[model samples]
Target: MRVLVTGAQGQVGYELLQRVPDGFAVFGYGSQDLDISNADQVRAVFKAVKPELVINAAAYTAVDKAESDAERAYAVNSDGVGLLAAAAENLGIPLLHISTDYVFSGDGDKPYTPEDVTHPTGVYGLSKLAGEKQLSEQCSRHLVLRTSWVFGAHGNNFVKTMLRLGSDRDTLSIVADQHGGPTSAGSIAETLWALASVFRRDGRLGWGVYHYSGAPACSWYDFAKEIFTQAADLGLLEKSPNVNAITTAEYPTPAKRPMWSVLDCEKLVDAHGLVPKNWVQELQTVLRQLGERQSV
Candidate 1:
């Protein structure tokens, strides 16, 4: 099977490149290789590859910047996804699109199900929600996987930022009010591979919106503390900082974040028979990789 992975240099795409299963011909492309925002470019790449499956990991991911650059965000997240969905629909291939938990308004304490209403609070979330709507309307065979708090070895993420800050600063303050699962890009990529394998065998294995993330919800403060603790255990940190917990208002950004963006993974678990590892365990593995790379 031929699989095309977009945003190949991003965290999730990078992990996908490393974890591609055997018997599959994978073609990974970064934004420079094929910018999804350009319709012609997207079409040209799809025509050349003619992939059996397409996994779109590209997006305008800068949450705070999106506030000032709404146009670019919509062009990339919404229109770019529309182009891919159209191509996949024309080719009769299944398209797997990655989404985020930010699509919901984050008003409640309970986990959000797939059927929950989406009232995005920021430009980034609104753009992503538009993409999801387009995919549902334009493509029949597509899987939109919604995840949260993604971090991995490749690309800039919370884990790397926390490691850097913890090493440089004597003390750091993080928001404790915002709660969500910290998913590893490696885990999300592996789950996508499992779903793609099923699609390759039979084109009908429950194709729709699904939520998947690390087990056990946590706040940003808890996540940072865990990252520092793991880094110290792996001997990656020179000195750990005193991480203080604060409310979301204290640590403000340009965009408003969901206070409770945790997604329920029951649908994914029931259909794909998959459950992500705990966030702390994933953090340890990432720190271990970082240490190994530094040593080498």
Candidate 2:
């Protein structure tokens, strides 16, 4: 089966490129190759590839910046997704779209299920929610995977940021009130591969929304401390930074983040018969990769 992957240079997309299983042809496109925001370009690419499946990883993911740039965020996140869905719908192909947990207002301690009401608090979340809605409305065969706190080897993510900051500063303060799992893009990509492989054989697997992330949930402060700990274990940190916990208000941003945005993976687990690894274990593997790269 032929599969098309967008945002090929991104964290998740990069991992997808690396982890595509045997017996499938994967074609990847970065922003320079195919800008999904352009309907004509999207149509052209779909026409040429005529892929059996399309995984859309392209997105405008600047959470704080989206507060001021709502239009661009919507164009890339919502409109781009709509374009891809339209193209796939026209071609009778399944579209697997990536979404976010930021769609929730983040007010409750309980993990948000697929049926939970979405009340995005910022432009980024609003745009992503719009994209999810568009995919659901436009395509009959679509899988909208809503994930959170994605980190991976090949892109700008919290793990990389914390690693850099841990080396640069002796003390760091991260918001403790916010809670969610630190998902690895590699894991998400692998799950997508599994889902896509199944969907290719049986189209029944490519409908409805699913939530996935690392097994356990944690706060941003906790995640940072874990990153430092892992880095120290890998001998990557020269000087360990004292990561302090602070309230969201203490580190105010233009965008309002959800205090509790953890997603319950029960539906995904049941649907795909899959399980996510512990977040700390995934973090350690990532740190090991980073250490290897630095040494190389």
What stretches of model 2 exceed 4 Å from their correct place? none
User: What residue pairs are clashing in model 2?
Assistant: none
Candidate 1's C-alpha runs over 4 A off are none
Instruction: Residues 1-296, candidate 1: write the lDDT tens digits.
Output: 99999999999999999998987899999999999989899889999999989999999999999999999999999999999999999999889999999999999789999999899999999999999999988989999999999999889999999988888899999999999999999999999999988887776769889999997899999899888877887789876789889999998899999999899999988987888679888888888888888999
Strongest candidate by lDDT: 1
lDDT of model 2 at position 200? 67
**Whole-model Cα lDDT per candidate?**
0.92, 0.90
Candidate 2, residues 81-137, lDDT tens digits: the string is 999998899888889989999999999889999899999999999999999988989
Where is the poorest 10-residue window by lDDT in model 2? 197-206
TM-score of each: 0.98, 0.98
CA RMSD of each candidate after superposition:
0.8, 0.9
Error of 1 at 16 (Å): 0.7
